[model samples]
Target chain A: MSTTSSVPDAHEGARNDQAPAPAPRGPVARPGSRLLHRWVWLRLSLLLSAPLAWMVLIYVVALAALLITSLWSVDSLSSEIDRTWTLDNFRTLIENEVYRNVTVRTVGVALAVTVIDVAIALPIAFYMAKVASPRARRMLVVAVLTPLWASYLVKVFSWRVVLSEGGLAEWSGLGSPGYGLTAVVITQAYIWLPYVILPIFAALERVPDSLLEAAGDLGAPTSMVVRSIVMPLLVPGIVAGAIFSFSLTLGDYITVNIVGGANQMLGNLVFVNAGAANNLPLAAAIAMIPIVVMLVLLTAIRRTGALENI
Target chain B: MTLSSTARRTLAVLTAAVLVLIYLPLLVVVLNSVNPNQSMTWPIEGVTFEWWRRAADSAGVREALATSLQVAAIATGIALVLGTLLALALQRYSFFGKHSVNLLVILPIALPGVVTGIALNNGFRGILGIDLSLWTIVIAHATFCIVTVFNNVQARLRRMGTSLEEASADLGAGVFTTFRLVTLPQLRSALLAGGMLAFALSFDEIIVTTFTAGGGANTLPIWILNNMFRPNQAPVVNVVAVVLILFSIVPVWLAQRLSSDVEAAR
Candidate 1:
């Protein structure tokens, strides 16, 4: 629509410019209007250039560098990247028991967190979007969003306090799960619950009440209505929420560090190799597990139109 | 929509329960801040303001807070510009790779921060041969923070349309004048909301900051992580956490208010 309209305006301006004299009538031809109006592609490119450069340079190039670095070998003694193409890092990842264990552990925790978050989020999101009054829904939204703004590390630390050996869990007779995979999953689920809820709630909001009412009037049970009508509609949202919890949990080392006692995930492996061991190539290889997982997850969900929902 | 009273009651109870559980850990942190026990054991030994006082006087906390503010401010400023431009271009133009551009903008955030972090870390140290510092943290933050600002501004721009700008142009207003007088006014609230979110995101971020901040720098989260397990400092960390949690409400509340205001205005 804008394109069609702008073309005539450009032509009209051109026709006026070709006139014998500048008439002191109609819209005055503003200076530099030629540059602004005549060159649509130029303006579009101008708008896009800075951000495109930033994204491509800082993100795309860096990501490509990481993949390239992963395939290269790192000199153990000097700790310098050899730049020779080899699959040793990938080979080591496959052969090493520790890497295999951590990879499995990370994927397991991510799945658990995703499932837990989706389960909790569904009921809360339904109540917030469908059941609550407008005023109450607004308050609930604030309640959900406010916690997200709280510091991530601080939230994890609070969980550390709660799940400590002689802390709230023990004192309250829940028999503290101490700190490990369970702790990591619980803490992660707690932290990411809001991220999961918001998308499902947003999706539910888009599901018109009339649709549900129509289903109900058609003699469908409430469970059937949800299963056939609402649940299918919520697939995109649930997938979006799942993506958040899963990918977030996949890359989280901080939660694991604060809560996981004597356990490591893929993130911790990357951090330890990159930071302590000074092995960037190995860390890059470790990083690939999450990258590939996320790419696959994203591609799978792309067809569901969940990426836009996100 | 047609649930029984029993089901409705159950759903309400579950929501209330989840909300309580959500705030429970935060409540513990608030209590522990005042808890006299340095280890922050449950069933507090006694109440004391000592930790709060120490946190106030702590130089490390102050420096970390300053560093965090500086990084967040710079990163958010950069994100605001880049994000707004990207939003305008994508919303207004029919261009090739438009979908790809959208994906690229979202990629940093959608992908795990750890991957983004280590990738940038390697890029800076290995490929670029630049030393890591607070600036690297800012760069890494701006990369991901772009998405939040981009989403907010893009949503606003889509809703705004180009009618007003076109009208201004037809009236012989220059491009700069149209943008300043027309577009900027409409975008003000969006920019504010996005900027606030970007600031909050940058402020609370730790994972990317971890790899980017390198050895010498400390953001508030980094500070808390380092001091969290230290003897006697745990209580002080709790005090900081309490303060942070309380302070966080302002941006979230403001963003909510601004967005609702936009909705109401419409």
Candidate 2:
């Protein structure tokens, strides 16, 4: 639409200039307008140059470098990158039961967190979007978002205090399950709840009330109305929220360290190998698992057109 | 649309319960900040402002806070420029690889922070031969921060059309003049909201900062992590956290105000 409209003006300006050219009585505007018309590509290039350079050079190139580095082997004792190209890291990852176990554990925790968030988010988001009055909706939005701004590590530590010995759990007479995989899942779910709530609530808000009315008018039960009508449409939003909950949990090692007791997630494994263990290549290879998982997840959901929803 | 009174009450009660659960930990932090006991076992033996007083006097706390502000500010500035430019170019022109550009912008945040952190760690030290510092942290942050500003600005630009710029050009204004006089006014609020969101994101970030800040820098999250384990300083962390949460309300409100309804929520 924009390109087609701009073309006529470019031509008209050129025509107006040509009609006045070769007279030389006044300064000719022909060259300038004609140059501008012919230089549309240059304008685009200029607009794109800085950002394209920034993204490509800094982000894309760095990601590519990491993938390449993963294929190379690192000397453990020497703490140096060995130039010899080898698939040893990949072979090691496949052969090692620990890596497989950690990957499964990380993916399980992520899925559990996503399911918990979605289940909790659904009702609350529906109530906020559909049941609350205008003023209450505004206040609820603020209430939901405020905690997200609170420092993350602080929140995790807050959880630590709450779950510690003689803390809230024990004080309330419920047995403290203590910090471990269960605590990690709970903490991650707490951390990511707002991210899930906002998106699902936004999608729910966009669901027209008239559609529900139509379903009711057709003599469908409320359960049927929701199950068949609302549920299908809400899947994309749920998936969008799931992506955040899943991927964020996949990459998190800090929460696991603070709250998780002696259990290693994939993030912990990669982190230890990368920095503390001083095996960059192995760390890079371990990192590749999450990268590939995310790529596949992103591609799978791309068809749902939920990327824009995020 | 069709629910009984019992169902409505159930939903409302559930929501209220969730809200309580959400604030429970934060309430603990706020209360623990004033608890006099340095050991910080939950019951609140007594109350005092000793932790706040200590936090005020601590030089290390001051330095870390300063570093966080500096890193967030610089990274936010860079994201604003690069993000707005990217949004404009993508929104205005029909170009090849446009979808690819969108994917590239989202990749840093969505792919997982650990991957991005180590990727940049290798890129900075091995590939680029630059030592890790606050600048490396800023660069890593700006890369992820770009997505927030880009999404905000892109949403605004899509809603805003090219007709106004065309009218300005028809009035004999050049490209820069039209952009300055016409395009920018519409984008002001978007830029403000995006910049604030970017600032908050970089300010709270930890994982990438861990990999990139290297041996010598101290951002607030890093500071909080270090102090959290120390028995005496743990109370000080609660004080800092309560203060940080209090400080955050203003920007969160302002960002919500600047963007339409729930657009920023997205």
Candidate 3:
């Protein structure tokens, strides 16, 4: 209905376009043409300026400030940030055994979660893409996406209940791991499964069934066809999924606080330093670990074209 | 490839099983909200609506819900404008540092949430010389929420070529008028889908909100975190979670419907 009304406006505008050069113009039309048409750069700049300023001034500058803050030191007695620059925070991070242990633990858990999610997502994604009816496939997508909308804290808290003493695990006869590194891995994998699945499902959908049928017709076994065709195509999507789970798990503090019992990760270290200890410089330094790890992962996977898939 | 019948059955079974496993804990949460046991024991003792009644009457819960709604709404609004602008600029113009702009849009979401959180927190308090408040949270959320809106609008713009807008421009309609009448209607469904996603992302977000929210501000996620371990408030928290889970379906379904409608139109 609105489309029909717009058509008449377009026709009226076209009729005006056919008129002589001295046709009456609205008060706003002249500058609007000068701003939007006569000067292309002006138009582009206007469009780009707000979001670019937001990204640069807010995000980029803040990130740079965090890096610079990591080099500064905090006053011991005053708890004031000493403007004088130093590498003491990084030095402390290097020398501290606890930080090292936490870094190792955080990386290990992130990798575990990534691997578990991928392993689970593959067969399910393949089934959804290839085996399900169109209606069922859409239903499956919604089913997967629904959990992602569920509250992250609530999901983790639910895991805490399941892992607590005399909880669901005990009642189900699969005894809880009692809220530690293992609990963190399980809960994180569950929370991030949808993230992993969607990308893989999208990649799998792109694999043509005709090609698969041709492979079978040409006397290739199902396993050979899957290995040669589907798996390779799935790589970028899988990596995209892996990046999400890995990065999310790497920076998680709330999950650890909820179900990790006494265990702490890089996130917990940063949170503790920034919040309870009021040491922003040390917290900034601690944050560099995940930032560096993610940068490395992203750089390594940039060649995979998974970034676009993300 | 043609899977054998046995393999097909196995895969179907596996998928169903995983789906069940995914829903089990959520089911537990829903049941726990009604469980009469204060401790939330596994076996059902008796069902009651006591926790729901308490949650409805809880002042803290009411305030937190208001705060969350306000933050998510404002963040979604800001994100819609900035994200649409960014998407139009990137999609329509080939400019220098274009790839950099793309990367910048993704960085907030790609990097760890804690990293983005603390970076914004520092930028707000340390550099900007402002105290943390609900507005800081809105800023942080809008930053990341830009990606969803950008991705959706960019994809829509890519699919919808410049033909109609060009035709409108050729017809002597001013730029803003053409955009208002022609381009915007095309982008409406995409904006809705993206905005819905951004709202959901903001509503459920906690990590960044924790860093950016002031001492007095308590969003729903923050409230949930604070009350999760409290002995008397735990069941009420479950009731809140149940309500959230139930309400969550509306936006997801609406977004899905809008997107699918667009897809069918295409």
Each prediction's RMSD to truth:
3.6, 4.3, 3.2
Fraction of native contacts, model 2: 0.53
Q: What TM-scores do the predictions have?
A: 0.94, 0.92, 0.95
Model 1 in CAPRI terms: which quality?
Answer: medium
Runs off by more than 4 Å, candidate 1: A1-33, A302-310
Q: lDDT tens digits, residues A284-304, model 2? A: 889999988988888878866
lDDT tens per residue, model 3, B114-150? 8998899878877788999889999999999999999
RMSD of candidate 2 to the true fold?
Answer: 4.3
Q: Model 2: per-residue lDDT, tens digit, B1-266?
A: 48778888999999999899899998888898888777667688878998999999999899999999999999999999999989988888788999999889988998888999888988887678798998999999999999999998999899888777666555444466557768998898888889988999999998888888967799999999888878778889889988987887888777666555546546
Q: Which residue pairs of candidate 1 clash?
A: none
True contacts kept of 3: 0.62
Weakest ten-residue segment in model 3 chain A by summed lDDT: A1-10
* C-alpha lDDT of residue B250 in model 2: 88
Q: What digit string (tens of lDDT, one per residue) describes model 3 on residues A1-310?
A: 1232232333333322333333444333466563465456777899999999999999999999999989888899999889898999999989999999999999999999999999999999999999999999999999999998888988998888778887898899988899899999999999999999999999999999999999999999988998999888888889888888999998888998889989998887887777788899999999999999988888878865666654
